[model samples]
Target: MDVDFRSGCPIAATLDLVGDRWTLVILRDMLNGKSRYSHFLDSPERITTNVLADRLAKMEAAGLVTATLYSKRPPRREYRLTAKGRDLRPTVQAMCRWANTHIPGTWTPPADFMADKPG
Candidate 1:
């Protein structure tokens, strides 16, 4: 369930935008250099086609990602993170580190990816 915005809280606002199960996963994919729709579809999370389309649209609407046409023949589009989205790197890295330590058998993120830099 999403929290209704009743207070002037930054965390609440941010969560309202990205607190869903799939949004962060999509962002993680983009940070890992995935841009194409098919590439996102192929992620281990196995997001469905309808859910992928909806989440991509929502992310684009939130100004975290930009979609560009890569192929006109088949109407292919590629998604990339904007500066705002890239700003989420530290948060993501923090979560990765926490998960690696708290959760057993979870793979640690690559050193380069967690180097406190923009995605």
Candidate 2:
């Protein structure tokens, strides 16, 4: 998909791909080790199957995630973070930290989640 940038700003460019509420959540799930489609469905946020499928496809197209065949009989797949996806770790971590400090009910993300290594 051709991204028509509104400006040359880097933030605007990044937002063009991941500004939506669900995209970041999907990325966070991948970071947290939810590799299978079923695992994503089990998230507490309860993302609909259709939306999850769409976001996963889009992320794949954008080089963020890659789906590999894990089950042949059921034709199931598991996703992994590409280097581009791992690059979003800091952005996700910053958002989590901000929420933990500013949002009254928000809990801090685990230390490992913010670690450099992908789970």
Candidate that scores best on lDDT: 2
Residues 1-119 of candidate 2 have per-residue lDDT tens digits of: 55577788999989988887688998988899889999999988999999999988888988899999989998999999999998999999989989988889987787899776745
TM-score of each: 0.91, 0.90
Which 10-residue span in candidate 2 carries the lowest summed lDDT?
110-119
Clash count for each candidate, listed in order shown: 0, 0
What C-alpha lDDT values do all the predictions have?
A: 0.88, 0.88
Q: lDDT by residue for model 1 over 41-113, one digit each (tens)? A: 9998899999999998988988999999989998999999999988888888889989998999998877878
- C-alpha-based local distance difference test score of model 1: 0.88
Model 1 residue runs over 4 Å out of place are 1-6
Report the Cα RMSD per candidate. 2.9, 1.6
What TM-score should be assigned to candidate 2?
A: 0.90
